[model samples]
Target: AEAGRFFCTAGRGLEPFLAREGLTLGRVRRVFSPKVDCVSGKVFFRAAARPGELRKLRSGERLFLLLKKHSPLPVSRNRGKMLQEIKSLVIEEPKYWLDIISVWRKLHGHEGETDDVSQENALALKRKSEEETNTTSKRQKTEQVRAVVSEECQVEAGETCVAPERTSNQECWIESKTSSEFPPKGSGETPSANEKLGFSFRVSCRCSGAIAKILTSQEIGRAIGITLVKQCGWRADLRDPDLEIFVHLNDIQSVVGIPLFRLPLANREYIKTAGLRSTVAWAMASLAEISAGSLVLDPMCGLGTILLEAAKEWPEACYWGSDISDLQLEGADGNIRTAGLMDKIELLKSSVKALPLPSESFDTVISDIPFGKKFKTTNDAQLLPDALQEMERVLRVGGTLVLLLSQELRRCVDGLTKCAGGDAAEASADSDSGAAPAQASSVDGNSSSLAQGGGESVLSRRFGSLVPEGVYAVSLGKTDAFIHKYRKVSAPGQK
Candidate 1:
């Protein structure tokens, strides 16, 4: 095993949360790239780690072992120069010596070349090539060497590593059975060269740089693969391999690594019914700020994603998830059973617009409301207002309601204003902006009057009127989707 630095990536807006999760793995180092859509962090875990430990991560979409991080090139260069730069970095870093040595060991598996046999062949070829006109046989060796180095480029840049020929075909990623984390053995304790592990590798490249404008991603991948294979004697597996390297190159910098986790950490095995992405669900739970033993409710719980995430984070808290759809409730039931959380979570059939629960019954309320697109019910026009009113009615003063929705801002504002007892007509007339709201329409899967309407600030004012205590919307990049956080206050005119 070798000592390695690793990084984890997440969706946009989830970098902070992913970084927080990474801290639990080891010392949090640096954010790899801030400008990219992905959030990545450098983490140092000094001891040997097992796959089980990484599987526990909640917010990360993918994890990779950092091979190198370099400053962006001053000017776009030809493939030859780029290959030269990569070779230099690997050469200067002794830590990469093990990687290169390991590359030779991996070659033993492909053509039945043993460790001793393969090195002897490479060295013999090396000598003969220096004497000859780089024979056709020598060129074949050079291509393999180049492929290994190109794979290094992929690992350097934090993009997937797949064989150049196989890049067009789907790649089957392989996980390491032996741990990558281990203290360097003393020279006396180190195994001989013959005993080292074998690994197959592929190089993948993503380009957002000036050079990228000239080179297609495939061209870059092919060139790097050819050079790396020729130089390192690394084996290439187009289908299944022991390792996959990645490269992400932008105008600002290049990132590379070997991925650790087979899938994003967000995909929990207990999830039988998947609705929102686990990352989104985790974010919703985090925003709710649940307290110990707090009573929480998701009135429109589609598949109990929010409740499941909250229950995992705050096991002591009581959770209640209800939905008007029997099918969805049944799926939530299966998931709850799979998680062995039937005792911690209560599932029921009920509509958000009219809950069967008592008023001020919950300490926290979090939900993913129908965007009026996928979650169309009978009274689509009045659904948002009705749900908000019910949520407010059941939430205790000072309780939090974190709601995710994708609808027109004006329609949402109007709905909340109406729910807060403000006359929609009066509120519209009082507006000095004089921007007419869009007519009701269907977007995504939900129906609402949210469209290309004016009066952008309407959501803030409407939230103020409804919550009174506090309110804010966390944008999720999409114009329609947002996580709306609201703290309940005494109803209008109450002391």
Candidate 2:
């Protein structure tokens, strides 16, 4: 294993979780934790790692090498200067791009032929002489004209025309690329014998902070691309490039690296019926702390994502997934077999309100309940309270219960806690497990559940036996959700 600096791309609140999980690996060192100083979805560290080792990370969406960290950049509002600064910073840096390039190759299953750059585009010269000679010359002339017209249009539309731009498909893209699209050019200089050749790459920039106020991601990416093109021996290929570089720039600092894979680590190939992101699902399971010989249950498990995550991480424990919908149960069944965890996980058809299992039979209950989209509460009754009661009923005393719920339901539970004169305790934003138990909030007397045709309030009955353990805020792109941890007590109103 080679020692190298790297960073993992995490969710907004998952920085600490990722850092902690990353440290659990052998020969990994923490360089910087974003939540400790800056609030971002990245964990910077150094590792003596290979391609296969980092892909096992469950908390982060993607991983990148720490190519270089720039010095404090000015809070420049000048768009032209900012683009120029970005270009100069990249090209001027003394970089060993080959080191990161080797890692990128192994990640894509290209373990061999990494030594010779010419092997990358064996047809580069042949294609350049035959198909691209005349046509490539013509396209360059047309592209220059298009650039002028595009800038004029931008200025007329009240946008900044700081840099010349290429056509949409001229550089890199998601589609396949033909050799004719990119011909190796060297500004009339011939390639040296030792010079690396035919390495195609694309630059992707993400902008935030003060610098973003001046330049868009597109402008920054183009500036970097123009500099890379000056390398004189490589092609810019966005679609199926040999290397992919990423630049995450802010007003104060710039982070540059290469992405490990095309798909994020959160996308699970084993579980085809994934309902929740595996990273978040793994976070949910971590809260449960399923030790060896533990019995875990996901009463409202849809597609069994939570159960599958738990089973994979803690093979010593057994899991049961129950769902009311036959479609969801069938999906879960297929996923269990596909993951090859048939002996570790089991599936059952059941509703959240009632369980077929005996009381206090399970050691932990973890679930990501439906929060009103793709699935809904049946019979127009609230699903939270019924879920809490049934989950509490099956979980043994002192067993952990973890739930992933929306903000609306969280407020409803918070209101119940306040009514009982107990303040809900929130864990620190950067906590490793992302959950800590709050003060015990319980309501006295018997109360009816929504699923039951009785006169009892579901909220009152749900909070009586479970003591709040902790809450973690998680971001899911367009929306935010919270993970709540609780412990079931032997007696009602007991802490």
Candidate 3:
């Protein structure tokens, strides 16, 4: 099989997230508008216009093109309307060119007309008319051109027209012309073309909810030229698609598309839960950025959601997940096997504080830190702190740690970090001003609290009691606590 393009979709307002990781906007190929499903109260991907001048593109180059062509409209009713309008344009104007000399002769006696004009004038007029026809016909092939014009815009049937290649400078004017005037006057439109076009591409994010939205949004899939052939339960993996589109829906919208072969997260079994949230996927992919070839450890793996996502995101790395509950591990194992990723992951049973792995082996650690009333621990207070110490011991000197917890558990993490010889600090120091901490209700039936205050206060309060300052001395530990701090790193000697 040929190697496919590597496509990475982003969430709304996440272009900056990709940019910070050294990815540029120019690498994207298309961005769909967002649509809301009235029945589900959920948003989905809508089809979008494909960027022009992509005929020569290699499969790998399309993702950047998608990002560069992102929609400018706000992802709301306004965006839905815009999608409708663009689709209408494509359906109404489907334009095509045909050699029209014979048709012109049939319509208006070609020999007599040529004889009447001077030889030079005949040639000039022919050239001029052909130029006009070429311009008009070229528009028919464009998405916008097809949207607006209906009648077959062809040269007289027997006439031949050749299109001259234009420079990049000339392309802008041509695109503008096609977008504005491809369909000149009256033309019937097709309903299929007008149906809101949706496009999506597979992204690095491994969240299930985000994946579901992409699979269900026909508009988004069609825009990127991907067809969802099947939807069995929450996960559908299509093999014979031109591209795989991923739609990320929030209050905001982001759509991405890439050719089928470049789909990094193709295995559905890797998605542990059908109801995984988009935020969690974003967090997993972001955390994958911290280490190279480092083993990831998740003590409270639950259904192995984080481990599965991490394994896909970092294929070069190994993953180990353990849980106290055998039922959750069984589900996780099934998911891993279903995804065909069992080779990359190892699952075991272990308590939070007493993991089977050796110390100083893991380079990065991440977990969803269980909470809520459903999960009862004999000593809830001691559980979190002890887990933190184990993580510290297992993680290498220059390693990284990421934990997802409720606001109340923040104090535990802080106290543990301090006890582990690192300063207690919030990871949001670099967050945009006035940004609220991301909030998600507990899946295990616990009340949720917003993560406010700085890292110190949040952690202190969550874990109960303030951790002593200077308990752990900061040595070579540089805390990369910012959410967007996961920068891609080259292997030790590679350029």
lDDT of each: 0.58, 0.65, 0.39
In model 1, the number of clashes is: 48
**Residue 41 of model 1, lDDT score:** 31
Ranking by lDDT: 2, 1, 3
| Candidate 2 local lDDT, 120-183, one digit each (tens) | 4433333333433577644553454344334422211112332655445443321221122223
Model 3 lDDT tens row, 69-127: 22322333443443443222112111110112222222222445533223322343343
- Residue-pair clash count for candidate 3: 53
Candidate 2 C-alpha error for residue 396, in Å: 0.7
Q: Which one wins by lDDT: 1 or 3? A: 1
**Poorly placed runs, candidate 3 (over 4 Å):** 1-9, 12-293, 371-382, 411-495
Top lDDT hit: 2
TM-score, structure 1 vs. true: 0.69
TM-score of 2: 0.76
